[model samples]
Target: MANISQLSEEERNDIVQRLKRIEGQARGVQKMVDEDRECGDILTQLASIRAAVNSLNGELLEAYLLRCIQNPDDFGSPEKAVQQAVRALVRS
Candidate 1:
């Protein structure tokens, strides 16, 4: 597996917080299931979690592109780097 660069402290914290919130939401969903909560409400929360995760993924990808692929003044192989990034992003 390719090693990813470390995130900034702020970015790291933000990701942790988002993950925590998602975790909590999942737990709540479990509780809802146990208590037989409204299906619509549970589904709504699940959808929200999915959207949040997708948004977080987009943010991380954007940061990676900016820092790894675009900001390098001496990429040595700029075309290859950009193509790789584009391909990865498209696959994502």
Candidate 2:
């Protein structure tokens, strides 16, 4: 297994930017509600936001598996880590 690796500054910045965009989407949804937009339109926006959040979750999970669970030094029991990861993903 590969050793655990820390996220580079650029990677961290990219994640932050993605999160900010998601935040903007959430705020837009609120505005739509306040404006009494069509239910269909609001629902569409909500679906888009959900997709973005799921995408973000996938990215984070990939990073965790690659940088933490794959590293024996970082994760004492890789099998246990995998189980935990799977459980969390299932719950999500």
Candidate 3:
């Protein structure tokens, strides 16, 4: 598998912030469970967290395609790299 290129400082910071927010959401879900909150409410929160994680994955995949797979200079076979990445993404 081709390695992902390094993210720019701004991109890294943004991803970190998004991850932190997700972490908070996870904690909130735990607290809700401990407090015996409604199952519906907890499931909703879990769905939202899953969506957030999927969004993050999409962003990272886009960055990887553009920075690593799409650059001929960076990867010897750009098309192959893209195909592999797309297959992996689909599998996930």
Off by over 4 Å in 2: 1-5
Which 10-residue span in candidate 2 carries the lowest summed lDDT? 1-10
TM-score of each: 0.77, 0.80, 0.81
What does candidate 2's lDDT look like per residue over 3-52, in tens digits?
Answer: 22377778778888989999999999999999999999999999999999
* Local distance difference test values of all predictions, in order: 0.76, 0.77, 0.81
Model 1: lDDT of residue 3: 25
Which residue runs of candidate 3 sit more than 4 Å off their true CA positions?
A: 1-5
Model 3 / residue 76 / CA error / Å: 3.7
> Residue by residue across 1-92, what tens digits does model 3's lDDT show?
44433777888889989999999999999999999999999999999999999999889877766665556455557676667667767866
Among these predictions, the greatest lDDT belongs to 3
> Model 2 RMSD to the real structure?
3.4
User: What lDDT does model 3 reach?
Assistant: 0.81
Better of 2 and 3 by lDDT: 3
lDDT tens digits, residues 2-92, model 1?
1234567887889889989989988988998999999999999899889988988898787767755654443446676686578659966
| Candidate 3 accuracy as TM-score | 0.81
